[model samples]
Target: MATVSQIWPFERRRCLKAHGIITLLFLDLCLQCVNGYLSSPHVGQEPPYSRDAQPVITSPVVPSPSSASPTDSDGYAAKCPSGGQCNRLPADCINCSYHHNCSYGKLASFSCKAKRGVHCTAESGKQQTNFSLSITCQFCWQLDLSQYRCSNSTSCMTVACPRKCYNATCQVLDHVHCLGKRVFQKRLYCNWTGGYKWSTALALSITLGGFGADRFYLGQWREGLGKLFSFGGLGIWTLIDVLLIGAGYVGPADGSLYI
Candidate 1:
């Protein structure tokens, strides 16, 4: 019985030692499994180490056009300059009357010889003002009254013209001859009178004609002395001179055009 008891104790001790070694091996395997689970990547998330390497996202910017009107340095719109004016003709104008319709501004009007059938027509023109660089465009229509446009050829028939008068030269006709001519075909001419201001001469002649005042005022020194000595040609010269002076026929001794 003692031998059997000793053998049973020895076998029990060996079995206990084997169980302890197995337990230690099982614990080491569990630790390895936990470490592998933590190191693996998640299904829908990036790895922590790769976060900073990703590129940043941004929206692009676009520019828009400007919507503003142009203005001068004075903050005002450009306009016509000084001494600039326009004159529009009447609707019923005829017989080359349209030629008188003109506009005068910073620049002079364009001139072209008129053909027999060709006549003046309305046209547009550009005028510049000192205030701005932009141009001032005007339609061709009105006549510019600010300018004086007249020539000697066209001055004679203005009063008798079928159209409006731009310039006319009228002379006095002899009373007897004028009344006798029924057709009045003859061209009337004004009596010869000095061009030295009819008003001034007439005033001086009346006030001092006997003293040769009219002649002296007309720059006629020799005629003035003769009239003064002749008592104005015994008053006959004074009467004739008064009539002649009233007419525009007589011009300045210097032959200069009337003012």
Candidate 2:
């Protein structure tokens, strides 16, 4: 009876240990199932709970139409019609450029002088079918007509003169009365200021006439040498030169003007 009682007590201990182990295993399984059910639905999605919603405030500043920037047309003093006959009147002229819109394959023409401060308009329009319109003003050079006009109001014919002419007087050189026709030839002469002064020539002729000082001063080297060797042609040539120089009959040899 003592051996049987010891064996029965061991069997009860074994059964209690088994029941505790099974209870622990079952509790672990239930906890695992509850955790998987909580996290499985949101595996690839955002959390269901979030922060509190906030009101978004927008900017109140806005651009007004009256305060808009100005364009190029605002600076222009006038405007021209597009694809029509241009106004030739001075009152219809613009500050510089007359803007237009041109169709493709058609030319837009306008006249403007660049030297007068007129400029070519900037091209602005569609690329194809409609082309940008601009009128280019070329630089022009104008000749003064007053320089070619005569004092008598008569037009002067262009003539080749080696000596530059200024304030010329026109005169008829020859008139031919042949048959029934009259041929008139005119010539223009300038007031020439060339040659030595008559006063100086006369003074030299009176003072050193025998030595040919007057002739040398007048650029007549050959006459000067002749007078020097001939003793002023026995003093007769000297006396004649005094009269000739005073009468303004003598002139410079080179045919150039005096300083």
Best by lDDT: 2
The superposed Cα distance between candidate 1 and the true structure at residue 9, in angstroms, equals 99
Root-mean-square deviation of Cα positions for candidate 1 versus the true structure, in angstroms: 42.2
Each model's TM-score, in the order given?
0.28, 0.30
Q: lDDT tens digits, residues 126-162, model 1? A: 3321111111122221222222122234233222223
lDDT of all predictions = 0.42, 0.48
Q: Looking at model 2, which ten-residue stretch has the lowest summed lDDT?
A: 173-182
Off by over 4 Å in 2: 1-115, 118-187, 190-195, 257-259
Whole-structure CA lDDT of model 1: 0.42
Please give the RMSD to the true structure for each candidate, in Å: 42.2, 39.8
Error of 1 at 154 (Å): 20
What's the number of clashes in each of the models? Answer: 7, 1
Q: Specify the highest-TM-score model's number.
A: 2
